[model samples]
Target: MSNKIKEREIQIERLQNNLSPIRKIAGWTAEVLGDKIGVTKQTISNLENKKTPMNFTQYIAIRSVLDYEISNNKENEVLPKVVALLLDCDDELDEADYSKVQDVVGTVAATAAGGTSTDKLDTVFDVLIKTLPFVVPIIGTIIGTSANWSKKLFK
Candidate 1:
Protein backbone atom coordinates (compact mmCIF):
# COMPACT_ATOMS: atom_id res chain seq x y z
CA MET A 1 0.00 0.00 0.00
CA SER A 2 1.06 3.62 -0.52
CA ASN A 3 2.00 5.81 2.44
CA LYS A 4 -1.45 7.39 2.42
CA ILE A 5 -3.13 3.99 2.45
CA LYS A 6 -0.86 2.82 5.25
CA GLU A 7 -1.73 5.89 7.32
CA ARG A 8 -5.41 5.41 6.70
CA GLU A 9 -5.13 1.82 7.79
CA ILE A 10 -3.58 2.95 11.03
CA GLN A 11 -6.36 5.45 11.48
CA ILE A 12 -8.96 2.74 10.96
CA GLU A 13 -7.31 0.51 13.53
CA ARG A 14 -7.21 3.38 15.97
CA LEU A 15 -10.88 4.16 15.41
CA GLN A 16 -11.93 0.55 15.85
CA ASN A 17 -9.74 0.16 18.89
CA ASN A 18 -11.31 3.25 20.41
CA LEU A 19 -14.74 1.65 20.06
CA SER A 20 -14.15 -0.33 23.22
CA PRO A 21 -17.68 0.30 24.47
CA ILE A 22 -19.17 -1.13 21.29
CA ARG A 23 -17.20 -4.33 21.49
CA LYS A 24 -17.64 -4.70 25.21
CA ILE A 25 -21.35 -3.92 25.21
CA ALA A 26 -22.62 -5.23 21.89
CA GLY A 27 -19.90 -7.40 20.37
CA TRP A 28 -19.50 -5.29 17.26
CA THR A 29 -16.63 -6.02 14.92
CA ALA A 30 -15.71 -5.36 11.33
CA GLU A 31 -17.61 -8.49 10.44
CA VAL A 32 -20.74 -6.98 11.94
CA LEU A 33 -20.21 -3.85 9.89
CA GLY A 34 -19.81 -5.89 6.75
CA ASP A 35 -23.14 -7.60 7.42
CA LYS A 36 -24.93 -4.34 8.05
CA ILE A 37 -23.54 -2.61 4.96
CA GLY A 38 -23.58 -5.56 2.57
CA VAL A 39 -19.83 -5.46 2.23
CA THR A 40 -17.62 -8.48 2.54
CA LYS A 41 -15.84 -9.16 5.80
CA GLN A 42 -12.60 -8.63 3.90
CA THR A 43 -13.68 -5.15 2.82
CA ILE A 44 -14.55 -4.24 6.36
CA SER A 45 -11.20 -5.54 7.53
CA ASN A 46 -9.46 -3.47 4.89
CA LEU A 47 -11.39 -0.33 5.78
CA GLU A 48 -10.82 -0.82 9.46
CA ASN A 49 -7.14 -1.54 8.92
CA LYS A 50 -6.82 1.57 6.73
CA LYS A 51 -5.75 -0.59 3.78
CA THR A 52 -8.71 0.91 1.91
CA PRO A 53 -10.41 4.23 2.41
CA MET A 54 -14.03 4.42 3.63
CA ASN A 55 -16.45 7.04 2.44
CA PHE A 56 -18.05 9.52 4.80
CA THR A 57 -21.41 7.79 4.52
CA GLN A 58 -19.87 4.44 5.37
CA TYR A 59 -18.07 5.89 8.37
CA ILE A 60 -21.27 7.53 9.55
CA ALA A 61 -23.21 4.32 9.11
CA ILE A 62 -20.61 2.39 11.05
CA ARG A 63 -20.68 4.84 13.86
CA SER A 64 -24.44 5.10 13.86
CA VAL A 65 -25.00 1.37 13.87
CA LEU A 66 -22.29 0.62 16.40
CA ASP A 67 -23.45 3.33 18.75
CA TYR A 68 -27.05 2.22 18.34
CA GLU A 69 -26.13 -1.30 19.32
CA ILE A 70 -24.04 -0.25 22.29
CA SER A 71 -26.57 2.23 23.57
CA ASN A 72 -29.43 -0.21 23.14
CA ASN A 73 -27.51 -2.67 25.24
CA LYS A 74 -26.99 -0.06 27.91
CA GLU A 75 -30.67 0.80 27.97
CA ASN A 76 -31.65 -2.84 28.19
CA GLU A 77 -29.21 -3.33 31.03
CA VAL A 78 -30.83 -0.57 33.05
CA LEU A 79 -34.43 -1.69 32.69
CA PRO A 80 -34.10 -4.82 34.79
CA LYS A 81 -32.13 -2.92 37.37
CA VAL A 82 -34.70 -0.18 37.55
CA VAL A 83 -37.50 -2.72 37.70
CA ALA A 84 -35.61 -4.60 40.37
CA LEU A 85 -35.30 -1.42 42.31
CA LEU A 86 -39.02 -0.85 42.05
CA LEU A 87 -39.45 -4.38 43.31
CA ASP A 88 -37.05 -3.54 46.14
CA CYS A 89 -34.03 -5.50 45.03
CA ASP A 90 -31.23 -5.53 47.57
CA ASP A 91 -28.84 -3.71 45.28
CA GLU A 92 -29.02 0.01 44.79
CA LEU A 93 -27.91 1.60 41.55
CA ASP A 94 -24.85 3.74 41.44
CA GLU A 95 -25.19 7.36 40.37
CA ALA A 96 -23.51 6.66 37.06
CA ASP A 97 -25.98 3.98 35.99
CA TYR A 98 -28.87 6.21 36.89
CA SER A 99 -27.40 8.97 34.77
CA LYS A 100 -26.35 6.76 31.86
CA VAL A 101 -29.69 4.97 31.40
CA GLN A 102 -31.27 8.03 29.91
CA ASP A 103 -28.21 8.96 27.94
CA VAL A 104 -27.98 5.64 26.13
CA VAL A 105 -31.70 5.68 25.39
CA GLY A 106 -31.45 9.19 23.98
CA THR A 107 -28.46 8.42 21.77
CA VAL A 108 -30.11 5.38 20.27
CA ALA A 109 -33.39 7.15 19.70
CA ALA A 110 -31.81 10.23 18.15
CA THR A 111 -29.85 8.14 15.69
CA ALA A 112 -33.03 6.65 14.27
CA ALA A 113 -33.48 9.60 11.86
CA GLY A 114 -37.30 9.54 11.97
CA GLY A 115 -37.48 6.37 9.94
CA THR A 116 -40.63 5.09 11.63
CA SER A 117 -43.39 6.02 14.01
CA THR A 118 -41.66 3.82 16.49
CA ASP A 119 -38.46 5.75 15.98
CA LYS A 120 -40.14 9.09 16.63
CA LEU A 121 -41.89 7.67 19.67
CA ASP A 122 -38.61 6.32 20.97
CA THR A 123 -36.90 9.67 20.57
CA VAL A 124 -39.67 11.34 22.52
CA PHE A 125 -39.71 8.60 25.12
CA ASP A 126 -35.97 8.78 25.58
CA VAL A 127 -36.11 12.52 25.99
CA LEU A 128 -38.60 12.02 28.75
CA ILE A 129 -36.62 9.23 30.38
CA LYS A 130 -33.43 11.30 30.35
CA THR A 131 -35.30 14.24 31.83
CA LEU A 132 -36.55 12.13 34.73
CA PRO A 133 -33.18 12.27 36.48
CA PHE A 134 -32.66 16.02 36.81
CA VAL A 135 -33.96 15.69 40.37
CA VAL A 136 -31.30 13.22 41.50
CA PRO A 137 -28.25 15.54 41.32
CA ILE A 138 -30.22 18.11 43.23
CA ILE A 139 -29.87 16.69 46.70
CA GLY A 140 -32.10 19.01 48.70
CA THR A 141 -35.06 19.52 46.40
CA ILE A 142 -37.04 16.53 47.51
CA ILE A 143 -36.40 17.22 51.18
CA GLY A 144 -37.43 20.84 50.77
CA THR A 145 -40.50 19.90 48.80
CA SER A 146 -41.48 17.41 51.44
CA ALA A 147 -41.05 19.97 54.21
CA ASN A 148 -43.14 22.53 52.36
CA TRP A 149 -45.83 20.02 51.61
CA SER A 150 -45.82 18.87 55.21
CA LYS A 151 -46.22 22.44 56.44
CA LYS A 152 -49.16 22.99 54.09
CA LEU A 153 -50.69 19.73 55.12
CA PHE A 154 -50.44 20.61 58.83
CA LYS A 155 -51.59 24.20 58.34
Candidate 2:
Protein backbone atom coordinates (compact mmCIF):
# COMPACT_ATOMS: atom_id res chain seq x y z
CA MET A 1 0.00 0.00 0.00
CA SER A 2 1.09 3.54 -0.69
CA ASN A 3 1.74 5.90 2.22
CA LYS A 4 -1.52 7.78 1.48
CA ILE A 5 -3.58 4.56 1.40
CA LYS A 6 -1.99 3.39 4.65
CA GLU A 7 -2.83 6.69 6.33
CA ARG A 8 -6.38 6.50 5.06
CA GLU A 9 -6.77 3.01 6.51
CA ILE A 10 -5.49 4.20 9.85
CA GLN A 11 -8.02 7.04 9.82
CA ILE A 12 -10.81 4.57 9.01
CA GLU A 13 -9.73 2.35 11.90
CA ARG A 14 -9.83 5.28 14.29
CA LEU A 15 -13.30 6.27 13.14
CA GLN A 16 -14.51 2.67 13.38
CA ASN A 17 -13.44 2.54 17.03
CA ASN A 18 -15.90 5.28 17.97
CA LEU A 19 -18.67 4.55 15.47
CA SER A 20 -20.65 2.00 17.46
CA PRO A 21 -20.80 4.04 20.63
CA ILE A 22 -21.78 7.19 18.79
CA ARG A 23 -24.44 5.34 16.82
CA LYS A 24 -25.89 3.95 20.03
CA ILE A 25 -25.90 7.40 21.56
CA ALA A 26 -27.88 8.60 18.56
CA GLY A 27 -30.37 5.77 19.25
CA TRP A 28 -29.85 4.08 15.91
CA THR A 29 -29.35 0.42 15.22
CA ALA A 30 -26.95 -0.72 12.51
CA GLU A 31 -29.86 -1.78 10.33
CA VAL A 32 -31.68 1.56 10.68
CA LEU A 33 -28.62 3.67 10.08
CA GLY A 34 -27.53 1.42 7.27
CA ASP A 35 -30.90 1.87 5.60
CA LYS A 36 -30.62 5.61 5.95
CA ILE A 37 -27.14 5.50 4.43
CA GLY A 38 -28.13 3.03 1.71
CA VAL A 39 -25.79 0.34 2.99
CA THR A 40 -26.47 -3.17 4.21
CA LYS A 41 -26.58 -3.98 7.90
CA GLN A 42 -23.75 -6.42 7.30
CA THR A 43 -21.73 -3.63 5.74
CA ILE A 44 -22.38 -1.47 8.75
CA SER A 45 -21.39 -4.36 11.00
CA ASN A 46 -18.23 -4.92 9.04
CA LEU A 47 -17.26 -1.28 9.26
CA GLU A 48 -17.96 -1.09 12.99
CA ASN A 49 -16.02 -4.29 13.62
CA LYS A 50 -13.21 -3.22 11.30
CA LYS A 51 -13.61 -6.42 9.34
CA THR A 52 -13.89 -4.50 6.06
CA PRO A 53 -11.95 -1.42 5.08
CA MET A 54 -14.40 1.49 4.62
CA ASN A 55 -13.94 3.26 1.34
CA PHE A 56 -14.19 7.04 0.86
CA THR A 57 -17.78 6.85 -0.42
CA GLN A 58 -18.96 4.77 2.51
CA TYR A 59 -17.16 7.06 4.95
CA ILE A 60 -18.84 10.15 3.53
CA ALA A 61 -22.29 8.56 3.51
CA ILE A 62 -21.93 7.21 7.06
CA ARG A 63 -20.58 10.50 8.37
CA SER A 64 -23.42 12.42 6.82
CA VAL A 65 -26.05 10.05 8.18
CA LEU A 66 -24.53 10.08 11.66
CA ASP A 67 -24.31 13.84 11.75
CA TYR A 68 -27.98 14.09 10.82
CA GLU A 69 -29.02 11.52 13.43
CA ILE A 70 -26.98 13.21 16.15
CA SER A 71 -28.46 16.59 15.33
CA ASN A 72 -32.01 15.26 15.43
CA ASN A 73 -31.35 13.50 18.72
CA LYS A 74 -29.98 16.68 20.25
CA GLU A 75 -33.02 18.62 19.17
CA ASN A 76 -35.44 16.01 20.49
CA GLU A 77 -33.60 15.85 23.81
CA VAL A 78 -33.21 19.58 24.33
CA LEU A 79 -36.73 20.72 23.43
CA PRO A 80 -38.50 18.86 26.23
CA LYS A 81 -35.89 19.82 28.80
CA VAL A 82 -36.26 23.46 27.89
CA VAL A 83 -40.03 23.23 28.07
CA ALA A 84 -39.80 21.58 31.47
CA LEU A 85 -37.49 24.26 32.80
CA LEU A 86 -39.77 27.00 31.58
CA LEU A 87 -42.82 25.38 33.16
CA ASP A 88 -41.00 24.80 36.43
CA CYS A 89 -39.79 28.38 36.65
CA ASP A 90 -43.31 29.73 36.33
CA ASP A 91 -45.27 29.56 39.55
CA GLU A 92 -48.59 31.06 38.48
CA LEU A 93 -49.83 28.72 35.77
CA ASP A 94 -53.49 27.98 36.42
CA GLU A 95 -55.23 24.73 35.55
CA ALA A 96 -56.15 25.88 32.03
CA ASP A 97 -52.68 27.18 31.28
CA TYR A 98 -51.11 24.02 32.61
CA SER A 99 -53.39 21.96 30.42
CA LYS A 100 -52.37 23.93 27.38
CA VAL A 101 -48.72 23.46 28.20
CA GLN A 102 -49.26 19.75 28.65
CA ASP A 103 -50.98 19.52 25.31
CA VAL A 104 -48.11 21.29 23.62
CA VAL A 105 -45.60 19.03 25.30
CA GLY A 106 -47.49 15.93 24.27
CA THR A 107 -47.68 17.04 20.67
CA VAL A 108 -44.01 17.98 20.57
CA ALA A 109 -42.93 14.71 22.13
CA ALA A 110 -45.07 12.63 19.82
CA THR A 111 -43.82 14.45 16.76
CA ALA A 112 -40.21 14.08 17.82
CA ALA A 113 -40.62 10.36 18.26
CA GLY A 114 -41.61 9.64 14.67
CA GLY A 115 -41.34 12.73 12.51
CA THR A 116 -38.58 14.07 10.33
CA SER A 117 -36.65 17.12 11.51
CA THR A 118 -38.78 19.50 9.50
CA ASP A 119 -41.93 17.78 10.66
CA LYS A 120 -40.86 18.06 14.27
CA LEU A 121 -40.15 21.75 13.93
CA ASP A 122 -43.44 22.29 12.16
CA THR A 123 -45.33 20.54 14.92
CA VAL A 124 -43.55 22.55 17.58
CA PHE A 125 -44.26 25.80 15.81
CA ASP A 126 -47.90 24.86 15.39
CA VAL A 127 -48.20 24.07 19.07
CA LEU A 128 -46.48 27.29 19.99
CA ILE A 129 -48.88 29.24 17.85
CA LYS A 130 -51.86 27.58 19.45
CA THR A 131 -50.54 28.23 22.98
CA LEU A 132 -49.02 31.64 22.38
CA PRO A 133 -51.66 33.50 24.34
CA PHE A 134 -50.49 31.95 27.57
CA VAL A 135 -46.95 31.07 26.60
CA VAL A 136 -46.08 34.59 25.54
CA PRO A 137 -47.07 35.94 28.91
CA ILE A 138 -44.93 33.46 30.75
CA ILE A 139 -41.98 34.17 28.50
CA GLY A 140 -42.50 37.90 28.71
CA THR A 141 -42.68 37.77 32.46
CA ILE A 142 -39.45 35.82 32.63
CA ILE A 143 -37.68 38.24 30.33
CA GLY A 144 -39.14 41.33 31.97
CA THR A 145 -38.18 40.18 35.44
CA SER A 146 -34.65 39.45 34.28
CA ALA A 147 -34.37 42.88 32.71
CA ASN A 148 -35.64 44.55 35.86
CA TRP A 149 -33.10 42.71 37.96
CA SER A 150 -30.34 43.70 35.57
CA LYS A 151 -31.38 47.36 35.74
CA LYS A 152 -31.54 47.30 39.54
CA LEU A 153 -28.06 45.80 39.72
CA PHE A 154 -26.68 48.35 37.28
CA LYS A 155 -28.33 51.23 39.14
The 10-residue segment of model 1 with minimum total lDDT is 81-90
Reference-based TM-score, model 2: 0.42
Worst 10 residues of 2 by lDDT: 146-155
Highest TM-score model number: 2
Q: Kindly provide the TM-score of model 1 when superposed on the true structure, using C-alpha atoms.
A: 0.34
Query: What's the TM-score of every candidate structure?
Result: 0.34, 0.42
Backbone clashes in model 2, listed as residue pairs = none
Q: lDDT for each of the candidates? A: 0.43, 0.53
CA shift at 96, candidate 1, in angstroms? 27
Which pairs, if any, clash in model 1? 8-50, 9-49, 9-50
Q: Candidate 1 on 34-107: residue-level lDDT in tens?
A: 79867777877776456776664564465456535534655433222222222111123355653454355334
Clash number by candidate, in order: 3, 0
lDDT of 1: 0.43
